[model samples]
Target: MRSVFVTGTDTGVGKTVVAGGLAGGLASMGYSVGVMKPVATGGILINGEITSSDLLFLQAAIGNTALDEKALSMPYCLKTPAAPAIA
Candidate 1:
């Protein structure tokens, strides 16, 4: 199994876009792909739950319905837009 980790020095970069693209591309090629955010700063309310858009994008990219397992993908999802420590 291969893994890809995307990181950026700051927020609002193309990390999510690039990661999602890679995951989507790999899945299209018939590869089994799993995506994780681990920690997220900002979130939006989805069905009464605060959800990370980046996680949702990654989940959609891999064509999986694992949103119910958000704890696995994004263990730390903060509603605040500040840094993880401050948020």
Candidate 2:
């Protein structure tokens, strides 16, 4: 039951990429990986619906676990390109 926490020095620092890569690698090694973003700043528009690309990548990496998006991501998402507090 080993776990790892991935954090970033600042926003847009490729945390998502690193996390997804780790999860994908772990899953390939026969580990049941779970990903949690907790908080995110940017909003990705998909098929006329606003979603988080980070979460989507995580789901793809982990083979789409039963966890819902709300449980994986934060509630508030900012539309601007800046930080959530500023956007």
Which one is best on TM-score?
A: 1
What TM-score would you give candidate 2 relative to the actual structure?
A: 0.73
lDDT of candidate 2 over 1-87, digit per residue (tens): 788999878778888899999999999999988777766556687656556777788878988834346544546555456774565
Worst 10 residues of 2 by lDDT: 65-74
lDDT of 1 by residue, 1-87 (tens): 778899887777889999999999999999998999988887888889888998999999989866698888989888888864477
Cα lDDT computed for each candidate against the true fold = 0.87, 0.73
Candidate 2 has an lDDT of 0.73
TM-score of the candidate numbered 1?
A: 0.88
